[model samples]
Target: MKTYYDVQKFFRRFGIITYIGNREAEIELSLIELQSLKQEGVISDEDYYQCLGVLSYEKEMAIEKRSGKQ
Candidate 1:
């Protein structure tokens, strides 16, 4: 996916709507889910890496937001 919203949409396709009241935690879980899907061969290497990159970017942005950087 290109963004966290896209990732959320992807998870929604499987009826997964996870939220533990923590944005960072949710993104982390999404990253884990993406990794799992990659390991299971459900997605290609390119797709896996692309999604991970998006998640990582989101995580970094979240951290920065929490730190009042942007």
Candidate 2:
């Protein structure tokens, strides 16, 4: 099993800032990051939802985003 620290490190390297918590926090953080990208015009709504699909997979897995969002 991956440790929380490992998950956090992966998120940091990919520029996705997520806090360790329950599934709700994971979903919220993913949404926040997705919204931030949309707000910055870095990703379209279609892309945001597509990415959210990947992030919302498991209950406790780490989520990552593509690197180029401003």
lDDT of each: 0.84, 0.57
Question: Ten residues in a row with the worst lDDT in model 1?
Answer: 10-19
Clashes of each: 0, 0
- Give lDDT tens digits, candidate 1, residues 1-70: 6888887887777677768889999999988888778778887788778778888999999999999999
- Model 2 poorest ten-residue lDDT run: 61-70
For every candidate in turn, the CA RMSD to the true structure comes to 1.5, 11.4
Error of 2 at 59 (Å): 8.4
Which model scores highest in TM-score?
1
